[model samples]
Target: MLAIGAAVLFAIAFLINAADMSTNDVFTSTNVMLIGLALLALHVAGIGNGWAGRRRR
Candidate 1:
């Protein structure tokens, strides 16, 4: 599930950032962590419910 994926991503980012609290971490940990949060927001907004489904006339 996308939520699970996002959770994993967030966790990984946290680990990376924690391991190297520097501005030059290889993974861009802050960015990745923000991305994960965005994913979580999407999932919370019901991304799985076919928000893009076209209305049937």
Candidate 2:
């Protein structure tokens, strides 16, 4: 799920960059891309797996 979120973020960033849209400093394509990368890292690290509350028996 986090990976999916990251992919969406990356897509948004790419679109923003490709379109050359003007945005605030905090919402720039680079910043969005960084955020996406962070999410991807978290996903890889087993964070937000959505299975922590479940028990396997």
Candidate 3:
């Protein structure tokens, strides 16, 4: 799920950059892309896998 969210964020950033759209400093393409990368890292680290059950032994 977090990976999916990151993908969406990446797409949004790409579009914003490709279209040459102007945005606030906080919402700039680079910031959005960085946020997406953070989310991707979290996903890779299993931060939001949605599975909290103990492993079977």
Tens-place lDDT per residue, model 2, 1-57, is 999999999999999999999999899999999999999999999998896676779
CA RMSD for every model? 4.2, 1.8, 1.8
lDDT by residue for model 1 over 1-57, one digit each (tens)? 668878999888888778875655545888888888888888898886455768988
Instruction: List the candidates' TM-scores in order.
Output: 0.65, 0.88, 0.89
Clashing pairs in 3: none
Report the C-alpha lDDT of model 3 over 1-57, residue by residue, as the tens digit. 999999999999999999999999899999999999999999999999997999888
The reply for model 2, stretches above 4 Å from the true place, is: 53-57
Predict model 2's lDDT versus the native.
0.97
Error at 6, model 1, angstroms: 1.2
Error of 3 at 21 (Å): 0.3
